[model samples]
Target: MPETALLPDSAAPAAGPEALDDTHYRQSFGALCEDQVVSATNAIYAENGTKLIEKGSRIDRELYARLVQHKLRDPIDQQIGIEGMVNHESLEAMAAALLDQATVPRLLAASLGRPAALLQPLRELPLPGPIALKLTLMRDRCPALLQHALATLLVAMFLADRANMPTPLRSHLAAAALLRDIGMLHMDPAWLAADRRLNAQERRHLHAHPITSVLLIRQQGGYAPEVAAAVFEHHERLDGSGYPRGLRAERISPMGRILLLAELVAALGHKFGEASPHRLGLVLRLNHRALPGALIAQLLPALQGDVLASKVQVEEASQRFAGVANAFEQWTELQQDMKPGEVRGEAFAWLNSRLAGLRQSLTEAGGPPEQPSFLLAHAAGDDLHVADALALGREALWQLGSICGHALQRWPALADAERDHAAGDAAVARWCAWTGAMLAGLPGSSVD
Candidate 1:
């Protein structure tokens, strides 16, 4: 929709077979084979020309040990076949089914002229052999991921069509959305568990998933470079807050922006269920700096009249905002004593700028930092107003926590600065502790 050209593929060249970490994938595939009918279509061989599995051999847990130990002559996805894998036909059916039931998909379909024509792009997409095999495995193993991918595809196409993009570009956007998460197939299943709190190293591994997916798509061939570029930027935010690479502004491609917004919409639907549309409105309002405004303007028509019917307690919201105010107050006090040239001062300055933005967003959303309780009390009886206010407050708190996490990640020196200035370090620790405790009380709030 933005019409920005695709960024050059400055990412390193696609990884060869030897560089891939396929152990986790092989283990997942093996487990899937034990449950589903999966087998080798050709003889699997190691790099040394030793035959591992004969052609047409049923692959299962027994073959997993053998497969994981070798550096294969070719990628395993190229040689394996899964029964009833997701092909173009099945994918079309899946999209049609989702349109019939899901609110967002239906809205997207109706937004695009002919409701039935929404599936045409997906129907025409080229699913190469290896990509199809990987998708089938994802369907059998990580069904949630597959579901998210399908939802993202519908949203991307809807956005592309609304922007008057060409048919070929629309096809490329659809492909990028659908294949963006395939890299997760190669990641350890444990790393994705909902309750698992990842350390910095684990988080870094998770963040590189976009790069992993780009490599996989490039190596598999048949896709245009635009597809890989869009996938690489799917997790990136326009404000440079996104991971793997902190790209900002027009540095992100037009297709990448469409894909990123689509990904967020799909994820919100999963995270908030019936209230996704409502929560999405608030997220967009607070994050106008991070997401494209024009695309959001187009999306607003669908969100209208989809307000949540649930009630939010005034006291609960009041407390949340009070916590937000207190956190900012502590930071202000700490900032007073900070020197501008030092590392900790620079870190605090960065945090201050982000927090200032958050404060302004909250005020604009009817919950000013200095007078949150007053605003909540005034809107106490109006359901829509209260919901909007509470949603804004919740999102602001979540983002505040996220800012702290990013600071810690971006400035490893923040921890070291503690050694030089114990008092300042203590104050920063106190602020982080307060924010964490406050966020724990919210239903879906987490630091990053």
Candidate 2:
């Protein structure tokens, strides 16, 4: 538990001060661009480090068991992202293969102006990356996966700035909060995997990550000294339970609060039993918006994956020219585009025929006839195959202004591999950025 506050100033900024408009939004953007922080995944990885393991291989179960010692077990991280931390809903769905939620399709969506990037990952740029800059991650545990987790953590901070806050305050908070754990990547894997937990000697070393992040930024020679200051102050919490320095709320920067919230959320969100990832996400999303907790929380279970089968059914249908099974398959085999709008015309005709049949069937039964609401079940020798109908259905859903992932829930098991990824690694860094753009329906933007 954190130390109690002795002195108190209960006043805070008004919850609804007239928001800065779009024009003012530019002012905020302009201010951010001026800040000289090599702020991208590549930059972060170079500044810190990540663990790298061979591709397509599972982590050593023995190593993981040993690493998750008694003290460490305090943090139960289910549904983590590529990095160890939990984040705003589990994004494994966005990045996972099951829904084509990764970078490429999202970029395509951005180019098409399909949706808003709000609540998406790449809320900001100048974030860290996946490639090795100054160090390699392979020497540690799941380096690539862990880096993604860190990126997810950073993404959480970026979104947290959404609450009515000042531009400078938000930026300060983002930078400091993101790099708070930079030093952890350097500790020996054996130490990280230690079973007995950290002694006082180990705790001292653990406190150094924030400092390591500060020094790295300064050494890189760009960010404002003020920014660096916040990084150092992050461990200094409001209640005085923090390490390195026990500064209270007044002394702690907003960045400190943000990072503190993130750390707490991350720590608590990783637990097993009652504090589930889905439950954690709902609570965090609500709390962060309402009060902005001292600790951040982005739960994994509440993460809604690629829209849904029904929505995908519509999208595929909308994209396809035919009415059913393998209709698009032949198209894929051919390199050239079909003659003009032939596919669209054909698909529409098939739809009309089906609609007409439905209307007639309803009239025959002396009932009101509207559109046919059919589930995707295959019937042998059918005029339209289930696959074709499914595709057409997706298009129809899109026409109705409902994107694929409208009704989503959390998945608790997806992010187990997240911690193994490295923070500041290049590959996962770019992926984070790309994934953000896709989700938000924006373009010409990068997360890092």
Cα deviation of 422 in candidate 1 (Å)?
A: 7.4
- Number of colliding residue pairs in model 1: 0
Candidate 1: Cα lDDT at 85: 84
**Least accurate 10 contiguous residues by lDDT in model 2:** 401-410
Pairs of residues at least 3 apart in sequence or in different chains that clash in candidate 1: none
Instruction: Give all candidate RMSDs, comma-separated.
Output: 3.2, 24.2
lDDT of 2 by residue, 117-162 (tens): 3223323423332212221232133343343334334434434543
Q: Using alpha carbons, what is the TM-score of model 1?
A: 0.90
RMSD of 1: 3.2
- Candidate 1 structure quality by residue, lDDT tens digits, 1-448: 3212333345544456655687788788778878988788899999999998899998788876678677888877788888888899898888888887776777667666576656788877779888998888888888888888999998888788778889988888889999999889878888887778766667777887888887788778888888988998998988888866889977888988999988998787667667777877888878888888889888878766456667877766676677777777877876676666545556555666788888887777775687768677777788877777677777777788787677667655444534554444545655665676767775545532
